[model samples]
Target: MTNRTRTPRTRYAQSLICLLFVWAVMGSNSALAELTIRITEGADAAIPVAVVPFSESEGIPSSDKISSIVQDDLAMSGEFRTLAPEKMLSLPSKRSEVYFRDWRLLGQRYVLVGALNRNGDRVEARYELFDVNREERIMGATAGASANNMRTLAHHISDKVYEAITGVPGAFSTKLAYVTRDSANGEPRYRLQVSDVDGKRAGIRLESKEPILSPAWSPDGRKLAYVSFETGRPVVFIHELASGNRTRIAEYRGLNSAPAWSDDGRSLLLTLSKDGNAEIYRIDIQSKNLKRLTNHWSIDTEAVWDHTGNGFFFTSDRSGGPQIYHKSSEDAEPRRITFGSRYNARARPDNDGKFVYYVHQRDRAFHIAKTDLESGEETVLTRSESDESPSVSPNGRMLIYATKQSGNSVLTVVSADGGDAYSLPASQGDVRDPAWSPILR
Candidate 1:
């Protein structure tokens, strides 16, 4: 056991790694269509803040409302309850115009005011955040983007205001990858799409009559790895976001599925059935070097990095039904981590490494749940009955997953602690395979 764990046998890993080149030879919204984000439920008590409609400086672009976008983004977080524009006592667009006593009387803690000015094909947003209690400007900044890129500018302002108030960087600027299935014509048509955190400016990445599954984002948020059956069988592919170019990364006899990225963005943890039964393997992205991570005979897949580069959490049926297990190192003995259920898989560790979330089965329904790494306590985070594909946001404050509602698949997001929740249902089809992008700066 000591030797086996220390030395991972190459098996056919070398040849498979060499196959890197074998396949290498082959490969917004409005301005993107955006996701409609609606808060189905909220926390028992949320922070009270007010976002005043910006004073349009005449030449500003005619597009989505900037202040409204930021307000919606903050409200969708389930952390802040924003006062409606109609309820604002004043339409102050600067710090001096803000009257703290008026906001205090409205029970608001923070106030955001801004103005938009057009510059050629671009717009400059000068925004200020004020502390109602202290009667002072707490945060102020200016952001410029093409007039057509108002959405991005709004999101940036939202991130700044959110960070200034909560001290935790907001994930409003991050992207999301999800798969949409449309069977309108008769046959199922799947599309891999990228969209904003609020589901706006959705740009399609891959479209196929076949199925696409498990979209995984790289650490840098530049590429996505997923399984596509467009080639008649399941093959793993890595696609560049900027160019829409892809290289077939894995193709074996049985299964080439479940692609997960390491922290360094240099390799992927995948499950391949070339040898017979399902097992886990790590593949270097550039060199195509392959290292076997699990040698078990049972089905083992869906392994995710621990961020510390120590080991990973995976699912296996070695104990009977699928269960979650943690490996200390490449060859270390596997220890079972999910004891509360006979079925738990798809472990997603937060950046802080404090909690791990996965698809959990309890009683008879499936829901997204997380386990406290230090305390061994499990908390179910969603009320959705048919949930799967759990992806955590960059800051680990929230997570998105796929679930079925009224017989249609929809994406649902909830706070990490299961406080407030929202759902994103496609306007025409079923959406699944949600992957949250890493924080990009």
Candidate 2:
């Protein structure tokens, strides 16, 4: 009996050590994930773009190419259809060399050109944006950063170009957190990970022998809240990244999961099944006081807080087959947000609180969708067989979700307006339950 007790302790210590060591070293080296293109649902049209190969201004080698990365980033947004240089009448490196008439004949609306040179410890990049129809250079900028920082610069350029065209802030600079599962020796393992907006830098933040679900990042991007079954029962844990400290937020007798952090990072709104029925609950982070928000006798989980912190949107089966309902802190009466679907509904509000996004499963296929809360108009964003757990970008103009493509679970990103669709291959395991972190600086 004593030997058996020692064995359990020894196994737990090994697991903890492994988890800590892997997480601590995750940020040291970033690895790029391979890109996989997929067709998106509800795509209206693709914008036409022309990107000529960059020019060389200074005495720099010819091998440090960045235009390819920029092209991939823009194409993945699902909004832009890139024009091949082979199809171009002329490859222009400077504004003077551009033949506006040739591009206009190709139905191109915009054109991009750039120059690159090696700086002291970084690469100097300069790019220009032009309006093909007007024959005008609308925007121009310069950036200088280390070679290792090229990816960051490319994302910034994407943000600028996206914003210039859409009249909304682009979310290309954001990051995504998600859940991945692995099977080894007939046992299942789960891990929580974070990656770049384009699905690069895939690294694990936490791992468990049991299931880990519903990962939500704090508004400040310093912490994460998730449900882990490490203790043989579902519980909520808040993990701080900088200090490597983890604190148990909930370990009640029944279900304690689906943690969603408030916009201000002051509290967490989660679902607890302690009262015999799954219901939404809000817990103050500082005081640790628990407040039962919904008294409904139906299953209510996956609570998402409003940007104002005055209300939250969640899913409940009260009306049969999960539907979305909005509950206000000012009043206990819940208002229904989704009225179309009869099978499943999960609400994920944008950062600005102007839109409420969700997943609608119809005819055995799940799609990412959204509702204009003010207009009550529903738009289906994805038409895939399975797309779930969407997290909106910081600017709320883009989203990342988990989907099955070619029989493999992978992470996919699409414009919030449902434009471009692309996938990120998992470096280690099958990925799911993606959550985008709020911008942190």
Q: Could you tell me which residue pairs clash in candidate 2?
A: 78-420
lDDT of 1 at 295: 84
Q: Residue 226's C-alpha lDDT in candidate 1?
A: 95
lDDT of 1 by residue, 349-372 (tens): 888878999999998999999998
RMSD of each: 6.5, 8.0
Highest TM-score: give the candidate number. Answer: 1
Q: Which stretches of candidate 1 lie above 4 Å from their native place?
A: 1-34
Residue range 1-441, candidate 2, lDDT tens digits: 377654643454344334433422222112222333443432458788887777766755444356766777778777788887788888777789888998999999999888888777688889888999999998889987786677777777777888888787666677777766766565666767777777766677787767777788998898989888788767799999778699999998767878988767899987776665577888998888988988765667778877777888988877866888897762668999887678556688876767898888777788888988898898888767777788887877678887776766677787888765677756545777778877656
Candidate 1 Cα lDDT to native: 0.83
lDDT measured at residue 136 in model 1 versus the true structure, 0 to 100: 84
lDDT measured at residue 79 in model 2 versus the true structure, 0 to 100:
78
User: How high a TM-score does candidate 1 get?
Assistant: 0.91
